[model samples]
Target: LETVGYTLVVNPKTCVVCMDRPREVAFELCGHFVCCAPCANSLGHGVTPARCPLCRADASHQRVMRRAASLHVATMADDHMHPPPPPPPRPPPPPLPRPPPLRPRARTTSLGPTPPPLPPPRP
Candidate 1:
């Protein structure tokens, strides 16, 4: 939430993936904050593997982001002792549309012998 006098908010750091939020979640292996916690949780979600956005290193130990008192941090976790609960699981993604059946190629029959290829001209 912005303050009463805060007309505009500009983040000094940005996630490479979202290009919006501050780069908060740092990967211990690469020592880079490729994205924030939400984005990191999002990247860590599902079967897909999470990797550092900058160096492409396999993100092992996710580190907490520490900012100066002046720097504004997004999300309730930054403020409250207990972070907000994860939103209800989203409905399973719609099933992928089945691909159309392939049609067999038509066969061509020639009664006469094929013509020979033309010779290339010398440069």
Candidate 2:
């Protein structure tokens, strides 16, 4: 259990394969948070999709679950733990420069300059 702002949060579920780390990945089709990222990647190797270990559902794609902040704030006056302030917002990037206008290309004959008119037939 984790304490955040005097509230208790339960994070007791661990990965099914490793049984060590907490379950942080959820199968898209089965909607089960039973495996960690490494375990899921191992199962879903190559072209074959991984099957849900719990429900046997197709788990070709899975998403990682974001854990809640572990910051602990006390209710009484003696507790001094405080989360750091967030950084200031960043400025927007500058706009890109416009490209120059394109000029029209001159039209040419298909036979490539007409072979200089065959030098007047070499009379």
Candidate 3:
């Protein structure tokens, strides 16, 4: 005989507020897994201002419970299904060194030599 195990899956897209996996917690009203604690709190108390995190349905009278089975499944799924977080960014490469400026060439003409003037033309 062969044995197989079944697991519950939580859809992240269904919940708008949860940062972590939705399977970590379960909804009180709809019995559907939605978001984490922060999201649950935002929906108001399960009995008072009750609201569904995913569908925004009225959940004032529903009961909230911690789902151990679902949480276990989520943890296992997380371990095998998720990709490793990206590495931290590296520092930019050092700026390139600038080349030295070229020196001006010396002039060959003598500094004190005077130039010949034009002769006067006949009228």
Candidate 4:
């Protein structure tokens, strides 16, 4: 059997304040992770003094951490476990028809535009 892959491991302890999805969350200068782009943007934009929720470090200087691939898998698993109701059936795929054979367009402007005259040098 083929292995699915390792689930992304998010450390709750490492998460300072936000409990939102790890994938959507970003780390502040203080190393505190906040959920959602709005939250992160709000914190960074001066609405709230960015600070690490856990360490109380200055969040203003913190850089956002890119979510690791492993974290993505874990997030997917969590979503699957608590999925919302499925949407209505999608429309059927359109029928595939053979594309018309390529015909090359006639080449115009074979020599291209004439070069402009050079300007005299300044004294």
Candidate 5:
């Protein structure tokens, strides 16, 4: 957008206040268009007084501009926004093997199995 006498050229996409982010705000005090959201919120909602960038006036409330203001914003691509897709899911682990079953001892007719003949009474 060009004015009659002078032209205020900006990178469009850059924040008017910080010149980093895309134009995301518009201070209502002065007709300065498109500052980033952080700057807008800080100026408007912050504890300190609001100050307009273009003119040194009170810019308390700012309008958040959306992507619809594409023309006024620079056309810089943010590749970091998108990340590679996650890896595919892995197969389930194999089932564990089962242990053998225990068995009970057999009983004998002699008393305590004859105590193994007592070693011939130790001679």
Candidate 6:
């Protein structure tokens, strides 16, 4: 008989707000993961409804609960199964307008057409 061994891996969950500490709190209504206890308290304790950083949902009235130490398991298999459609191509820029056509200017001299060039000097 042969036995196989496997190792379990757990990924650390970083706080979205602080990024340095682990995410220890979550808003009730929006269910968005937030920073450490201190940061979460400050954010959710405001007078007006505090907007969730991720989804902009109101988190002030909702309960702020601490998350238990657990592995944050996520998979991109769904993304592979149903991939998002590609964005539409950008439209081409408009063509520039053509400039007005050049017209031949009439030649005019202030001294009247020039005296016919003084006959040609006769030798």
- Top model number, lDDT: 2
Kindly provide the TM-score of model 2 when superposed on the true structure, using C-alpha atoms. Answer: 0.43
| TM-score per model over all chains | 0.43, 0.43, 0.32, 0.30, 0.41, 0.39
The residue pairs found clashing in candidate 1 are none
Determine which window of 10 residues in candidate 5 has minimal summed lDDT: 74-83
The lDDT of each candidate is: 0.62, 0.63, 0.52, 0.48, 0.59, 0.52
Please, what are the lDDT tens digits per residue for candidate 1 over residues 40-115?
A: 7776467768776666567757877765542443233223223223567989999999999999997879877899
Clash count, one per candidate = 0, 0, 0, 6, 4, 0
The candidate 6 region of ten consecutive residues with least summed lDDT is 73-82
Model 2 Cα lDDT, one tens digit per residue, 1-123? 557998955444666677777777766665666777889888857777688776667777787775343111111101312322455799999999999999999887686545555555665
lDDT of 1 at 100: 100
lDDT of 3 by residue, 28-91 (tens): 4344555565566666744556666555555454434345656653443344333334567999
Cα RMSD to native, each candidate? 17.9, 15.1, 18.4, 17.7, 18.9, 12.2
- Model 4 has an lDDT value of 0.48
**What does the lDDT read for residue 54 in candidate 6?**
61
For residues 12-107, write the lDDT of model 6, one tens digit per residue. Answer: 355556666666666555555554566666675546657665666665644434444322311121112222235579899899999999999987
